[model samples]
Target: MPYIPTRYFCLIAALVTLAIAVSARFATNDYFFFAGYVVLQYVVMATAWNILGGYTGYVNFGTAGFFAIGAYSAVVMHKLFEPPLVVSIAVGGVMSGLVGLGMGYLTLRLRGVFFAIATLALAIVLQTLITNWDFVGGSRGVYIIRPANGPFGHPYIQYLFLTMLVLSTIAVCIARAIEHSKLGYGLATIRDDELAAEAAGVPTLKLKLIATVLSGALMGMAGAPLPYYVTYLDPSSGFNLAFAVNSIAMPLIGGTSSWLGPVIGALLLATIQQIATVTISSALNLLIVGVIMVGFVVAAPNGIVGLFERGVRARRRPAKKEAA
Candidate 1:
């Protein structure tokens, strides 16, 4: 298609966010806001994961580790001295980004399955640490009290939904900006072949580190609101395998090649999961996600975006032949 300016994209995102906020005001049931919040959270997580896993060609299985860092960071803040939610969110992002940088420095040298294994190990290590830390409630978990009154007198859940909506927009816009930037090109080279990229003087390691930091920060920000949303957080919930699974699955299902893919994938999958949770049993949510992901892996390895791109190219081939 055509190259659209980032400013124009931001404007569109703002308008869409406004529309969602307005719609929430009219909704009678609070469940819509609750469910919407979760969907938007996945949108942020999936987009974040795509920065490294999709764009940089490094699959990170430690999504839950970074996510829990964000959540527990908030917990610590609340217990000591409750700061504004924004502050906790910012701190969470920074902590996760730092960890990402360290992880990249240590393991980016290892490619393929080895790197993936390292990240999964990182998650296992974090979970073990959190499980034993008594101050954060150890294995028992902790409870958080949501502020009784939210901004503008709206329900706290609505506020969270709006926060997540804005965050998802920011994440998408940032991803799109990177996709069109020099850094993105450098990262793409690394994705294609790190050795070749290094030989080509592409600064492969630096680019990969940047991708990891940005990806981790976004994931942490996505998790920062979890404490408030759930009102209770334990190692089990914070380190849930679902976060890692969904983060990888959504981008793959939507099409990882472009910034829009994860958003599309997250919206479709998360919404479906939400409906299934309500209609069927919540226990079946992961099963449903697994089944859908398997189908996509079998039939559309490149994802929905790839399928559409393929069709476009196919049509263009016939047109060029006719012209000749």
Candidate 2:
């Protein structure tokens, strides 16, 4: 397929996503809205994680670290100045982006497994810090009373859904732009062979830092609305392992080679989790993810998108043979 312009694609996606979110106000089951909110939140999270993991080939296992940073940033801000959600989101993004920059500068030189291990360690460290910081309620957790219903006349859940929808659109747009740019080529080089990338005059550190900051900022943005969504927050909830695992799994399952992959992966996986949680025991959710991930790794290493592409290529090969 020929390339589609980022502007056009994102605009259409934004409109469509927003339209669906708006229509969700009419949902008879409030549970549906709640579930959609969770899914859209994952959409943003997965897309953000993909920027570093998929594009830069840096597998950051600290998704929860950045997510909690944003969550607590908003919480701190809310307690200090009672800012609106938009301001909270902006502050969270800036705070987390700065943290990402620092972390990248310190660890981006490491490659592969080493780098991944460092990130997981980072997440553990952050969790420990949050668990003790009584200013944000420490391990006791904090309660937040959501704001009044939005001016749109729908319930707050619908507004939250729309907020996430907009965020997801923006994240996807940015990812697509980066994927098609010269920066993307540099990242690919690093992903394939960092030493070769450096030998070719690529500024490996600069590019990796850029990826880290962007990914962390987006992940932070995704978490900014959490306070109002959950109403009660604790270190455990904010730093849940599910965020990290799901973020990684979504992109991998969707096909990490492109921006669209995470979007598709998040929707499918989140939807499955939502259904499975209701039908089966909630304790089995992680087990289900593990099983599916292992199956995909063994059977479709490249993910659903890759499998679809392979099928198309197979069909084309037969048609080309007929033509010959």
Give the whole-model CA lDDT for all candidates, comma-separated.
Answer: 0.92, 0.89
Q: Choose the strongest candidate by lDDT.
A: 1
In the range 1-324, model 1's lDDT, one tens digit per residue, is 987888898898889888888878899998999999999999999999999999999999999999999999988888989888888889999999999999999999999999999999999999999999998889999999999757768888888888888999899999999998899899889889888988989988888999999999999898888999999999999999999999999999999998989999999999999999999878887898899889999999999999899999999999999999
The C-alpha TM-scores of every prediction are 0.98, 0.97
Candidate 2 off by > 4 Å: none
Worst 10 residues of 2 by lDDT: 147-156
TM-score of 2: 0.97
- lDDT of each residue in 178-206, candidate 2, tens digit only: 98889989989888898899999999999
Off by over 4 Å in 1: none
